[model samples]
Target: MADEETKAELREQFTEAFEGADYPVSNPMDLVPALPDGPGTRFEAGDVSFTAMELSTKLSDIQDFPYDDVETLVDDLIVGLDEKDML
Candidate 1:
């Protein structure tokens, strides 16, 4: 299990990495982190949900993640993570 400090660092890196990108959605989903308490991180938009760690791995593995838009990025991330059973 990851320690609090490690999780915090990962969370920070994850947030910064995503926020740094250009989200096409005018009102992108809000990042709802479940840190220091809950299971993991999630992004909420209407009835949709996103897992941060899965997204992070998806991004980190890419030479440079192509999508600049959050909508597409999250959509692809979910599919990829799900296929890998990481979601």
Candidate 2:
């Protein structure tokens, strides 16, 4: 199990990764043809998993890519993972 400090560091890394990573932000309709069938935007940061669709929506709503709800979710997921001793 990761300690609180480790979890904090991991969460910071997750937020940085989200902010730095470049995803194809296009119209949902336009993206259909761009992405192959069954292909997904699943990312793992430490013990947390994120999907592109959810992130996209949150990013749009927040007007701050890689912040807001994404950060909260990442924090919660990290805490949960730590509690479960999965990190």
Candidate 2 per-residue lDDT over residues 1-87, each given as its tens digit: 655666676677545544332343233333323333312555444455555454444344333223334465456546555555546
Listed per model in order, the count of residue pairs whose N, CA or C atoms clash below 3 Å is: 0, 0
Deviating ranges (above 4 Å) for candidate 2: 20-68
Candidate 1 per-residue lDDT, tens place, 1-87, comes to 334454344444444445544443232232333132122555443333445544555545532345555445545554554455443
Best by TM-score: 2
Model 2: how large is the Cα RMSD against the reference? 8.2
TM match of model 1 to true structure: 0.34
Where is model 1 poorest over a 10-residue stretch in terms of lDDT?
Answer: 28-37
Alpha-carbon local distance difference test for all models: 0.43, 0.46
Model 2 residue 73 CA deviation in Å: 1.7
Model 2 quality (TM-score): 0.39
User: For residue 10, what is the lDDT in candidate 2?
Assistant: 62
Candidate 1: where is the Cα deviation over 4 Å? 1-21, 24-54, 62-64
Model 1 lDDT, full chain set: 0.43
